[model samples]
Target chain A: MECTDFKLIVVGGSAGSFSVVSHLLAGLRPDFKLPIVLSLHRLKHVRSGLVEGLSLKSKLRVIEPNDKEKLQQNTVYLAPANYHLFVELDGTVALSTEESHNHSRPSIDHTLGSAAYAYRDKLLGILLTGANRDGAAGMKEIADNKGFTIVQDPLSCDIDTMPKEALKLFRPDRLMNPEDILHFLNALPG
Target chain B: MQNSEKDYNYKEYLLILKECSPYDFSEYSDNSIDRRIKKIMRDQGLNMEELVLKTRTEPDFVEQVVEAITVNTTELFRDPDVWNHILKKVLPALKHQKKINIWHAGCSTGQEVYSLLILLDHLQILDRAEIYATDISKKALEQAKKGQYFYNFNAEKYRENFKASFEGETVPDFDSYFSADADKDLLKIRTDFSEKVQFIKHDLVKGDLPFYNKFDLIFCRNVLIYFQGSLQSKIVERFHENLFPGGTMILGSHESLGGFFKTKFSKNGPVYHRTNSFHFKY
Candidate 1:
């Protein structure tokens, strides 16, 4: 698919993701137009105010996704605290609790893999700082469907496990620091 | 019935795993498979033969089963000591390579790529490096390309690890990396360094290698543990083919190339080099 047609961008992380996310957004421009989603693995009991916290660093509006929320360009959506977020065929968000995959409810795999299937070539998958391999298979699904893939350099990550795991499993298109990733996204034709 | 006489049904599960998914549980350690299978049975409420029968009749069930069995839990630089090792040993050794090609296979979301980029940027080699990051999941890839992460969730851990990695040195202020918007929804990466890297879609299981057997350095860390011995062996063979002569390969700290290949290369910490003749074990 044409690069401009790539409307969906998903970012997955768990532990140590905040700084990576902060660094990435610090480099991005306000005019960025893709629909960015954050799927962070969290404890069921923990209150995930990620959308509110990250809004401080980003130019786009950030909010926790609501049921059947229609995805829009230049907006950032966070997967709700306890549900897996998916991209519907009509370019809207769908939430589910249909059992956890890889021991995660708001699993990076479920959200990302499902989005890959729905968005196909118009998707971009990003795996950031996390402690587990939650996003690895989802990253693979993105590539299989001909979507762009990027991984934070594990060496620079606060917790290298997730990025390191991904580096070992799939061949991503780029390996960059958060700064570089921010720069790249800001430069996108959006 | 005797202990041995009880129906293990090993062959049936093996056939199912081989035919249905890319995983081959047959050659895996029996204890690991047994534990995983037990968990699968317990979770799905199925016995061994029943699970096999369900798989045969329901193709979608196989996807759930594969998801259950794979060891997908990971973090960014799960093992920081390994990164320390690379920083102290591997990067210094490769200082001479003018233009570097680094492949971070299975880069779920761009965390590890950012980590490596930070290292390269510090070492003054990032400009000369071309990092090829790939994965099988497009969702993860999309996240990786965007490079935006959750600030409040990861800041503390990032600071702690950053201190450990730098040993109290003044590191980059991560907060300065992103800008907050009016609605607090969108985050974008700055353009300065983002232009250097390229994000693409690639599947190692079924797709062709991009560099065509000429990567200068490859990082294939903890991913092989999910594959059975045969598939792991095949992937290692592919890695061997993808690397240039005397190129480097980095694996996870817990993982080793034991019995997978016969090669003579100096183990520089977690990184392995291809010295003389590189053979494809498969």
Candidate 2:
């Protein structure tokens, strides 16, 4: 699918993804129109205002979505700390406390797989630096759904296990450092 | 190429499940169920066909599959602020009643049940409350009934949640609730709390709501997210019918009412109250 045809942009990471996410957000045009979801792993059983913390650095409007909240353009949705976030067929958010996948809640695999199923080929999935293999299977799901996939270059990742796993599992459309990812986000059709 | 084949196998597995049993997975969203089946396959070291054969022949295999699919992890006072809100705002409104009936519909492992008991104990009304804690997983229900959990249960985080839940109030000694087991890494809930809770095995998706008496409060948290929108709405309607007029229903922090029931829920505590007279569907 063309970049303009994409309905949503999803990014998944764990451990060391904050810097890249913040940088990507900082580089986005204020008028960016595609909805973006951040499925970064977080400490469960503790209330952390990750969305609020990241909003300080992001130019785009960022919020933790309520269950069944509709998708909107030019906004960032952070998966809540303890729940698994899913994109529903109706383009709304659904959160589950179902058994954690890969030993992590807010699991990257759940988020990416559900988004792939929801948006089909009109989705772009980006996997970033992390120490676990959570996103590998989800990346494959996105590829299977004919969506575009990108991975942070393992050579440049601070913790390369996550991206390396994604790369090993399937071929992503792009493998670039944080700098190129930021540039790519800025260059997308608004 | 390989991933698409896996997807096909997942569908076949779901079909086999439906054909062999009274349950229907056709209404569920495929991705979540797909991942769960994959995990089952990996953990059992069996491909889809072998798994299907086991289910067809084995008497208890289907329950195990359902358990794996629906099981959710929970701990005491998770999202403590919400529990605190229930204590301060929700409980007081029902104070006029001489006895209170509470239902924790998806009470996996009974953390919430014990938490509620603790709160009631603090309020000195523990004797008057009867809680029915239910889950689809018999294994989880067995654990909840035992009231024993790993000693590794994050005391620091529990303390933090307690402080946040109580805000300015003096927090109870969180550790005092559980008696340490002789084994290094286990703790059992004090008998006082465990005695008041009743854990039952029940399925929310395909099974019927078996309660004869309407409840004063119902908690169905973090459970509906696995179902499709249609199933979620259907279950919420059933909950609405099962509740006494003005009885409160608490969903997970992230959960909300979908379909026509959207306007039925009032928003102060994000707790839905049934306003109309109740009627049983059957």
Candidate 3:
């Protein structure tokens, strides 16, 4: 199946990912049908700025979904701060105040791993720039689930710890920079 | 992945839970349930079969498993902004009431209970307030009754949150409601505050309301996030039914009411007000 045929797109990132994520969202056409779920590491005490910042750069609506909110196409759902966002089989988001993994609430590994399980081969996972290894195991989980996996190129990142750690696991399908990622997603089969 | 439960499926485990205990967690969100089960197996050094065997044979052990399944971590002023909103906005409306009944459903470990107690005290209505706190886990209920915490775990964060909630208001001295034992690293709730709260073991998913008071305010925060969507709706409906007309119920910040509840409660963030005439759902 073509990449765009996937039911969900989950992007996990931490440090140095803001610019890359912004670039990717900025370049996507307004008609992009794939719902992108973001599990970004954010300051737990600070909650308001991320979606507002990202929304300014993208045509698609960026949201911090309420617990039990249904997934919608043409929308970008950012994980709410201090909660883990799990994509349920019924296609609604379940937020939990459960223990943090890797010292991070809204753990990328959790969001990506759960999406891999829920969407299986219909999931496209993007592990982007960060200073930690949180998304690496999740990226591996995506690969193991036969889902499409993309890691942001280390050379193109502000901090390479995330993708570099991911590379140590199974090789992802693509190691693309911001521009390549944008273009590839734009050209995905409708 | 160590000593993994190869076939201890959630459905089977839930069935075991239902048979062995009064608790029914089949309506919990699947991923949270799955992870908690794995954690239980890994921590206790029990395989799937051993875990199931223990649960089926030992009533006490099943209760322990239920304790392990329930997530119980909460802090003083965990979400200070919400508390601030409650203090500044929600609690004021109830200040003049002759009597106030408040229930904390799934009041894990009691930080949230004391947080509200302080608010009631600040409003000078602590004497008139009837505070009932209940949780499914006996261990948590015991801790809630004690109303004590490790100072190391609570001091700094508690101070910070307390400050945030009373930002413009006169901040009380730290020694007023709690005392810190430096050598023991313990934060003991002053008896005056602890004695007022009546802690009970109530399961929001299974058991009847701990007491039927037609509560004026309810706080079931962070508890329902573990629940499945339909369960979330059902529990919200239950809270709605128990809420007095024009009463307020606060849920977790991340949680909101769905289903016909979207129309039943007037929402201001997680602060939901019971509105309109009551009707039985078909």
Candidate 4:
């Protein structure tokens, strides 16, 4: 799929995501204009300071979004702990706990599926190192919507189950290592 | 009236609520609604019988009941762990952004907004950020704009929350957070931070969004539960439209968007993002 109009980039992971995200952000330029949404499965009971921890490594603006909060370009949005985050049709960020899917409040499928529905052909869904099959159907949904889909090369993934599962469900447009993924992302016209 | 009569009357009272209030308590979890009504009745010094009878006749009584039913109990930094998380995980990511816009919905009495301002100040990024605090209640917005609170009310709680969430060794003095008059109207924020936040009266239910400015972060905690499913979805969709491509959205600890919108975000913890639609698989 051509990613010409794809402005939103969703990255989903769970176990061993910190290193992967760091690598991805480190590879991108500081002035990268695309919006990046990170959905990391976290313990519902613990305080997840993923945004603050990741902020130290990247030059982009990182934040925990609020209700009715508008989305901006070139920022990193971290899902708050114990809440499911969704993108509103208007392209703003919304948080909810209305219910749990995949037994996770901030389910990767929920986020990826929503974006696929909202952005259609312009969406790019990425599933990286993760433990569960949370993102399998979501990757398919992105493809079904004619949006671009990418999975971390399972051989290189810390936990290969998620990317492997996604690959089984659908053939993604790109399957590359972290370094190559960066080159691929940088090559995209914003 | 018999006990059964009282039960029927209670159901009728709830029906009246459905007719008058925007929220339909009929479909709300029964135990929760019962608990709220019981608390309202007890607080108003009225037994169930009296409450039912009085509510039927008093025109303004429904408004009181509406107020009692709505969830208005919010404190500054209501959840310190979340604040701690933001401090440790979120703010440092945006150090390079030239300007930041933060929307604080349900910013009742401005405590949360001040708490945020303090957080930004501590990070030394207060000058680069703009805060928009909006709420449906005019009275709450006015109080937030005033930026004052009573010392004896919940001052201790605020201080404790702040201390617990703060990352620095020398916690900023609470006095620095606010100023006070002889009458005890403790203005919780300095003018600079206060000025940075633009206060507007917005009804998330009916009216249009106030500003056209796209925000970097939006904090809408504990506001959508009051709305019905459709309204909640509509508002969430509106929020999506208001944001720039990579902005963040934060919700209350207990809230989620399961029934409302699609999730295109990478979950960090409490915050979500509208992934830049520009990044497609090459």
TM-scores for the candidates: 0.49, 0.87, 0.93, 0.49
Extract clashing residue pairs from model 3.
none
- For candidate 3, give the lDDT of residue A38: 97
Decoy 1 TM-score against native = 0.49
Poorest stretch of ten by lDDT in candidate 2 chain B:
B273-282
Instruction: Give DockQ per model, in order.
Output: 0.01, 0.62, 0.65, 0.02
Residues A61-151 of candidate 4: C-alpha lDDT, one tens digit per residue: 8887765466788898887765667765678665654345676768888788877866788787788988888878888998998989889
Q: What tens digits encode model 2's per-residue C-alpha lDDT throughout B1-282?
A: 776787788887888888997567766666678768888889889887899999898758888787777756888788877888887888877776789999999898887788887777767777888888888778888889888887665555656765677665667777677776545777778887887787777777754756554798999888776777788888888887778878899888887776467556565676778766334233
Question: What C-alpha lDDT, on a 0 to 100 scale, does residue B154 get in candidate 4?
Answer: 62
Each model's Cα RMSD: 22.0, 3.4, 2.7, 15.9
Candidate 3: tens digits of C-alpha lDDT, residues B1-282 = 421343346668888889778889898877788889899999999987898899889988887788889998788887788999898889899888999999999999999999999988888889999999998989998998998899986687789889998877888776798988978999988898888999988888863764776899999989988887789888888888788998999988878776678778898755889888557553
Grade the docking of candidate 3.
Answer: medium
Model 4 stretches with alpha carbons more than 4 Å out? A1-190, B1-63, B168-170, B180-187, B226-231, B259-262, B277-282
Please state the CAPRI-style docking class of candidate 2.
medium
Higher-ranked by TM-score: 1 or 3:
3
Q: Which has the greatest TM-score? A: 3
**Who wins the lDDT comparison?**
3
Model 4, B218-238: lDDT tens per residue? 888877755545666666776
Score candidate 2 by lDDT.
Answer: 0.82
DockQ of 3: 0.65
Q: How do the residues A74-162 of candidate 1 rate in per-residue lDDT, one tens digit apiece?
A: 78888876566777667767554334667786889878887887787889889998888889988889988898999988877888888
User: What is the C-alpha lDDT profile of model 2 across A84-147, one tens digit per residue?
Assistant: 8988778988776776779988889989998998887899999999999998999889998999
Ranking by TM-score: 3, 2, 4, 1
